[model samples]
Structure formats: structure tokens, C-alpha cells
Target: MRRRFWLLLPLLSLAGALQAQAPLDLPQQAASAQPAEAADYQVLDFDWQDKSRQREVPVRLYWPAQAASAAVPLVVFSHGLGGSRQGYSYLGRYWASQGYASLHVQHVGSDRRIWTGNVFSLIGRLQDAAKESEALDRVRDMRFALDRLLAAEQGAHIDRQRIVAAGHSYGATTSLLLAGARPPDAPAGLQDERIRAAIIISAPPFYGQGAPEPILAPVRVPTLHVTATEDVINVPGYHSEAGDRLSVFEATGGQRKRLAVFTGGSHSIFTDRAGTGGVTLNPQVKAATRELTLAFLSSVFEGREEGLQSWHQRWKPLLARWQ
Candidate 1:
């Protein structure tokens, strides 16, 4: 169930919008703050219809401190092929603390449990021979989540100008597709215009026979593609090729498009504090990954140019081989 970016064409999908003032549709838009000036963020779980998985999807959300009554920047996080809402918790917490609204979505059939036992059942869904609909479901899921969130009373509270889509591996592919990166044979309807930025981590070359195109190619928004040269899953497969594809975006007009490679890290290196078995949890990979991811997010989200510099300074020695 850990989906590859190359196999994306077969699984694109959709979400329905909720009406305003519906608490079930929106939940509490903001986080609760303690009286003592403690860390404040709203973490809530909500359900959305996932046509690809044919079930109601649950999402975990985090929001920044109540600094403004208007809409704030938003960061929607997606998990890897076999991941859950909890997979990208690190980004959610970090962004929420920095004044952005973030959400982690759970993909039912493609989650860890399914991958553990019924992976074939999920894979069977993608048996369209051509894999034309590979990521169709995930695309729908992202769109519906956006619709539901924006339709919520608090949805209006989100700063549409700064909406960002981010994820790891398959999730990163989802982020890219939502941001409008199309494989040569991709369906036209799958694009979501609301996404203003993208942060893709360890995405693969799953777009079938399409020539290598940067995930940021069609996106008019800023984008950050983060990968690890040591990534056993992607480096030899997708990361190297994607840079060529995404370069097209610069011509299309977006600001600050960048690709950051972590020298000593692996595919799952961008994970939260508690990383998956293959990436963050490993003793040798933990600290370096944590520092790099935190710094990358800080720079990309907070506009702290130093975030990039700090990452290079710390990892340049390890990544010297990449250079």
C-alpha cells in the first residue's frame, strides 16, 4: 500500500462540500488556549466522504494561536500510501505553532492496516490496466477536504492566499497533483486551483510513461520539493528526474521554487518526531532528519531564508557526495 508516484494515474478521486454553520462539517475551527499562555492550537477530527476509498475519511487538524479574526494561512498534510492522519503530525504541530492551519488526512484502504493485511484489495482497485486512475481517489479526497474546510464557518477564516499542500511519498505526489503538476497522460479535471504552495517529500516516478517533469511544473504557486539523496525509495527512481520536470514551473511564474535534498537521510526522513520504521525511528537517521525537516519547514513557511542556509551548513558534509 505504500504507493509509488509512478503509479499515480489510476487513483485520482473527489469530496463534497458542506454548508456553512454546520458544526459537523467544520468542527471548532480554532484551538483552545490555556490561561497561563501555554501553547495553543486547535486539534480536531472530522469526517469527509472519500469516493476513491468509498468511505468517510477522518482528518486531524491543528491551528495556530488566535492572533487574528480573519482567515490565516493553511497547510494541508497528506500521508504516504500506507500512512494515516497521524503520519504527518510533525508538520501539523510545527505549522500550527507558527500561525498556520494544518490538517492530516487518513486514507482508508491505502493505510498501514490495509497494507498489512488487505493490500491486494486496495491494489485491486487500481487494476485499470493502464493505471489511469491511480491517484484519482487521492485527488478527490484532497479536493473534498478543501471544499468541506472552506465551506465551514472557519473555512472562511483560512487565508486562501497562503494555502499549501504537503506530504510524504505518495502523499507528496498527492500534494503535487493537487498543486497542478500533471503527468503526460493525467486527466484534466484532477487539478485543484486553491493550492498556493506545495511541499513534496520523497515522491516517486509514478506518472506512467510521461517524460520527467517537476512536480511543480504546472503550479503557479511557490513550491518546495524535499528529498534525501540516501533515500532508498526515491533517489534512484523519482527525485532526480522530478527536478527536471519541475523546472518548468519557474517559466510559468511562481516564487521561490526550490528542491532541498537531505544528504544522509532516507525516504521517510521528513516524518514527524516519531518516524516510521524505515526513516525517522532509526537511530542513525533520527537527529539529522529532525533538524533538517524542522529547518526546512521554518524557512518555507516563515520565510526565514536562514532555514535553507542552516540546513546546508549542517548537512553539507554528509551530502558532499551528492555535490
Candidate 2:
């Protein structure tokens, strides 16, 4: 009973972290209508294997319905811990509508099974050294997925130069690895040169080892960091404060780095179907994130800075803290 009580307490804190939409006294300007809606998009599901890693990664691909003038840009998504490729459909769907391919890849180890075994199992694995090495494994999954996708028949429709790595939470860490964020413990040659840019959603600070700045020094690619002021992920043995996300944004050395810190959102906002409550569902937060991320990708993927400029001009007021 005590153990269960301790576990549920964090979940309650997480629930309580979500605040109601702004009150009448605290008025907020709505964001510019980000082209969040994708045009028509097609979804395909497949299980791909990496013989070197001896793992089969489940992937859900979302691409523009109509053929493009040239190959469409692709963003490979890695979901948060215990989350499947299907987790953040909002990002996948929105990007696809805008004529980009969004591929969500699932890492088998340290995945959904961790949460399903018991309510507390997921939290337990966070500090489990045996399970700690899985982050590197997840990085391998991203590289292998890219190798296979760019070689498949469908590869003909993807713009090889515009591939971006994106993820939230632990998945965000995986994307960072691909973008050149190296943990001292991770093996050499894990970073991929093909990932031209990256979107890091709720990336945690490199805790206890050293300063997050030096740890993230290797990630010099164009990057975007997305998180909420109240964003906190409380696992059993670890502490994830909003500062964790902020540290990554502040420390990154990317020449074109951007941070979108929204007001009153929680860790759950990154997922499509899951909402912690009112704050995660706030229209202002949602609109700004969707539009800002789209604009960032637009700038990096299409080699056009217009969308990003429009974002700065129109959505600046809604963003609580940004650079």
C-alpha cells in the first residue's frame, strides 16, 4: 500500500500541474493561425528489422496524399518512454497535412511494456542500470530506420537532404543523440550525420554528470526546443523539473536555435490523445506549439526562412518565453 501510494502521488502531482485556461484577469493573445492542418495525408504501418541490432522497430508513416513536385521532406519521430510510434499523432498528422512525411518509430526495449507490466514498473525502470543503456539502443533504432527508409521504394519520394530528427522526453534524448548530443556513457559512432536538423520536445538536462552545456556542445545542427513552463516528468528515482528543459535550450550551441516555452502546459501536451487537463488543452498553447514547430521545420526542411519569420512576427505575443 505504501509503495503504491508513493507512486500514485507523482501522478497526482502531474495531474495537479495542469492548470485551467487563463482566467479573465490574465488575458492571452491567440497565436497566428499556424498551418497546423495537413493537406491530405496517407498513413502506412510496418515492422522493420535491423539485423545488426537484432530488433524489429514498428513504424507508422504519414505522408502527403498527393505526390509532390519533388520528394517531400521527412521528419522521423521518436516517442517518449513507454510510448509507441502512435503516441504523438498530433505532430505526425499536422506535419503530413503540410506536405511532410512524419515517421514514428517504436523502440522495443524500455517501451510500452514497461508501463503495462504494473503501474509503477515504468518508473522503476528509470533508475535500473540494466535498463539505462536502452537509450543508446533507441538511438540505433533511429539510425537503422533512416538507413532502411532512404533505401526503400518509397525513398524515391523523400528529400534526402531535408530529413529531421524529432522526439519528446526520452525519445527527445534519442533525437538529440542523432543530432550530436552525446552522453559520456554512450558508445562512439552513434550519432548520425544524415540528420540535418532536429526538434527536441521536453529534453531533460544531463543531470549529475556535468554541466548540460558541455554535454550538449556536440549538437551544432539547427534545432528547436519545445516545452511548457510547468513541464515536469516525475519518475520514481529521478527529478524532472521545467529547468531540465530550459537547460537544454540554454546550453545548445546550434547556430539557429529556437525555444518555445508556453504558459501553463504540462508534460502531457506533447501527446495528441493524452491531455493532463485544462492547461494541456489550452488553445493558445496548442496553437503556438503546432505553428511554431511547423514554421521551424518549414524553415529548415524547405530552405525557406519565410515561415519562421512569420512565426516571429505573428506569434511572438503568445509565446511566454522564446528566442
Candidate 3:
């Protein structure tokens, strides 16, 4: 018995050593985490046809008037339910102004047409969006957008390795799927391996009261989730509260995940479009979104830690919401 105990002591010591050597996964939090005039950027437009999906995806491309270099980062922006590719033009222009090629992709079935004439139909539309087929189609639209851009002549200007998948509300859900977020019963191949980072705003849990662990299980990529204290969507058979958005922030597995919560703001703040259930527009929120989004992207794509650190130091006091 004494001989066996002594032999096990060495194994226990080795186990302790291994445990001590385990990596610490501390999240890179920021108070808030930009584009400027004279940023040397411009916009170009195109309409793409996804023959397989039978969808006409109209895209607005925002890029530097002159290529900054042989390659620049790409950011694809998807808008919320009842939003258009052009809905988030502010983000596209801002990113392009900051030297990225921002591609705004329009998801047909769930675009502005959903709210065109009847606000009463929103619940039905939301239910439809929750269906597996509709969700997968949205992801396919993004993947196909990547394919078209990477295959285009202008594709030469893009740094394929630094692509960002970003979206607002329902669009945020789409971006999550692309960034490896697994909803309750989603299809395979929804995640695009080319996505390096993601920016999701007002994202829904899509877990339906289930444990968020598995809902966000696939979200291993760097993600920045932005939402507001007033970011709540309650309708018949559907509800999206702040907790749902933050679940992504908490459940996503990575040291690079971040979250920014805005006080006295609405979920519509994430979308540039106003009149979204009376979301009073606030420029400060917009500014914070622009600055922090750029900083987050810089941190991941350019390895510019200083910008993130600077954001943490400066905006931590300015922005009321940080976690």
C-alpha cells in the first residue's frame, strides 16, 4: 500500500502542474469600443443574383476611392428584420471611410417588405424568420455574397483573411450563424470559416429558454455584442430582451468577446433606420457604435491593441454601459 501511494504522488504532482499551466481566458472588455473625413473612401453599388437561392441580393459596396494597399479588410453588414441592404448605410460608409470595403447584403424574404404596409404582420414575419429554412437562407445569402465579392475583379483589393460578419437584430442572428453560433435546431455549414470576427447588435437568443451554452456553442470567433437597456422587443409569440442579447456576450467561448450596453437607447439604435417603434435617435449612441466597432475590428484584424486600450480608457467614463 505504501509503495502504491508513493507512485500516485508523482502523478498527482504532474496533474497539479498541468492545471497550473492552463490558459486564463480573460475577456477583452472595453468601455466602448471610427471613421473620419479625409479617410480616402468611397462607395460603389451592385446587384447580385443568387441563382441557387432564387434571390436577387442588392448590395452597396463602400470602399476607398483608391485602394489603400493591395488588400484591405472587408466588413459585411446585414440589417434587422424589415431592413434593407441600404438600411445600415451609415455603417457601410463609416467603415469604408475608415479604409474597409463594406458590403451591405439584403435578405429578400425578410426585408422592409415585411413591414411595408402592415405592422400587424410582424409577428408572423418573426415566426417565419425563426423557421429553420428562413434562417439558413439568410446565412446562405451572406455566404454567397462572400463568394461573389471574392470572385469579383475588385476582390483583389480585399484581404480575405480579415473579413468581418456584422449585423443588427435579426441580421445579428444571421451574422452569429455565420460566425459559428448554433441556434436550437440550425443546419450544418451555416458557419463561414472565412469570418475572422463579428459585430452583433440586439441579437436574439434563438434558444427559446434553453441553455445559452449550446445556443452560442459555435461562436468561438471574436465577437462584439452591442445592445441597449431599452433594447426589448415584445410581440405575440416573440420576445427579445436585453438578457437575450447579453447571453451571446456571456456564452460565446473566447477571450476576444466583448459587449457594449447603451443606456436611454432603443434597439433601433443598432439600426440606422428611425421610426422603429419610436426609437428616438441619439448621435452619442451612434458615435459610440462607430468608434467601438472600428476599435474592435482594429483589435482583431490589425492587431492594434492600443486602439482597444485607448477606447477602454477614454470611453469607459463616457459610455454609461460596460460589462
**TM-scores for every candidate against the unseen true structure:** 0.70, 0.85, 0.82
Q: Residue 204 in candidate 2 has what lDDT? A: 68
Task: Write the residue-wise lDDT of candidate 1 on 141-248 in tens digits.
Answer: 777788888887668678777778887767877787787776655668776787867776666554434344444446666666665444444321222333432333
Best by lDDT: 2
Instruction: State each model's CA lDDT, in order.
Output: 0.57, 0.71, 0.68
Between candidates 2 and 3, the one scoring higher on lDDT is 2
Clashing pairs in 2: 38-97, 39-97
Q: After superposition, how far is residue 232 of candidate 2 from its true place, in Å?
A: 1.9
lDDT of 3 by residue, 141-239 (tens): 899988998899879888888999998877887898899876545557888999999998777665543677776776888999888666666553445
Global fold similarity of model 2 (TM-score) = 0.85
Candidates, ranked, TM-score: 2, 3, 1
Q: Write down the TM-score for model 1.
A: 0.70
Off by more than 4 A, model 3? 1-39, 117-126, 274-281
Clashes of 2: 2
lDDT of 2 at 200: 91
Best by TM-score: 2
Best to worst by lDDT, what's the order?
Answer: 2, 3, 1
Q: Which residue pairs show backbone clashes in model 3?
A: 33-292
